[model samples]
Target: MDEERNGTGTHLSDAQLFALAAPAAGEPEALPAHLSLCRDCARALREWKAAVGAVGEADAGELARRSPEEWRAREDETLEAIRKAGSHRHSIPAWRWALAAAASLVVAVLVLTARRTAPPVAAVAAHATPAVAASSDMSAADAADDRLLRDASYLAGGGDVDSGSGLESRL
Candidate 1:
């Protein structure tokens, strides 16, 4: 009986007692001998087995008595609970789609405006060439070109003809 201790404690945990109560064939040798000599462990194991059997019987009876309608209702309740607990919403709202479209239109209008206002690649490259000297005629020509480009961009952007620096104001 002393040999059954295996140099560890005399008592067993609930899991160890449960394993001993329902063991597979030809498991470790020492547990049965220990249970026989230990009155406390033997009594605990008996109680554990009885409790497990009673729970199993109750579960079997409950399952046997369940009707199809009751099962469906239970399943629906479980599914509803799962839906409520889920993180994702159903779908994006209409306002979000409208905002996105408005944002896209703003971006497109900005890109078109930028393209229209930007100097042509050829004109930029022309300026890269060294000039002989600063000339008043060249400066005047550059100013006229700038004013034309600005007027063209303002008109293309749908500036009101009846208002703002129109032909009447220029005249």
Candidate 2:
């Protein structure tokens, strides 16, 4: 960056001056290149940086010391503000949309992969029901459950399991 404005000591164009002096002031990029190397521009940049810092410090000083919960709330509020800012803002880079899209695709793939690779459910029920169905005239759905409980109770009580209950015999 040439420091001198053409070495003519003439004032620079307004865009050139702004780009050098107040870069954070949203100056567009088509400014004069010489202004970048100017000592005056360097000084102006430092001044603006200092001014912005002081203002930030003053704003921070206005707040009181907060409790832990208040600190958490403030943290949440700051994060929420940042979230709202990232979501709806137009002044920043346009590439953010591409980044967000990429992240969403990654998340979608991860969810799909997890679903695809997840463990299969046990097949204990399928084999048992059909085999029991062919062997017994009893509706295996109801009778098998009754048989299981009766067998478990008989085993637990150290007694012989009866072949047929009075209800089944009557049926």
Candidate 3:
């Protein structure tokens, strides 16, 4: 690829043609010596320059066709937008901070009150059903599996199988 690009015999690549067509701002690129000798590359560069010029001219023509009123409205809208952007508040309002602090305090108070009012774990466990009490002696995995199976069975409308209650009684 390097040889193909640098070879004086070969035509300029599309990228090289574009660079020649639109040189970088404040930085002029030296034209390849081959471009002067190669009519095909020179013509391609001219075509690229024409295309780039057409793109810029198209937008200018569109703007030129706009009515004076439309131009003024567009200018006003742009200025208003710039003004609003510049005037944007960077700091939060005092009321917002106060409200947030109050909200946090309320939530903390509610959490603490709930904790105080709730029954202790031992008391709750004491009131649990025989199955729940029995699970206390089982391994964690076994207990989790047991709970899942119980939930599934309950959801399926099948009451506890070990409760001595027949399906007829449940129905």
lDDT of each: 0.69, 0.63, 0.76
Comparing 2 and 3 on lDDT, the stronger one: 3
Of 1 and 2, the candidate ahead on lDDT is 1
Model 1, span 44-158: residue lDDT tens: 8788778777777788987867899999999999999888766245344666788999999999999999999999888876874433233333677675555555566677898
Error of 1 at 104 (Å): 4.3
Per-residue lDDT of model 3, residues 1-171, tens digit only:
132543458877888877888887746689889879877777788898898888777868778578999999999999999878766643336667899999999999999999999998888877676676678888988876776666666758956656653433434
TM-score between model 2 and native: 0.24
Q: What TM-score do all the candidates reach, one by one?
A: 0.29, 0.24, 0.32
Model 1 stretches astray by more than 4 angstroms = 1-49, 54-81, 84-89, 92-104, 131-171
What TM-score does structure 1 among the candidates reach?
A: 0.29
Best by lDDT: 3
Best by TM-score: 3
Q: CA shift at 39, candidate 1, in angstroms?
A: 24
**Mind giving the per-residue lDDT tens digits that candidate 2 earns over 46-161?**
56557666776677863644568888998999999999997767645567778888999999999999878865445546756775675577676767666666666665776644
The 10 consecutive residues of candidate 2 with the worst lDDT sum are 162-171
Q: Model 2, which residues run further than 4 Å from truth?
A: 1-8, 11-28, 64-171
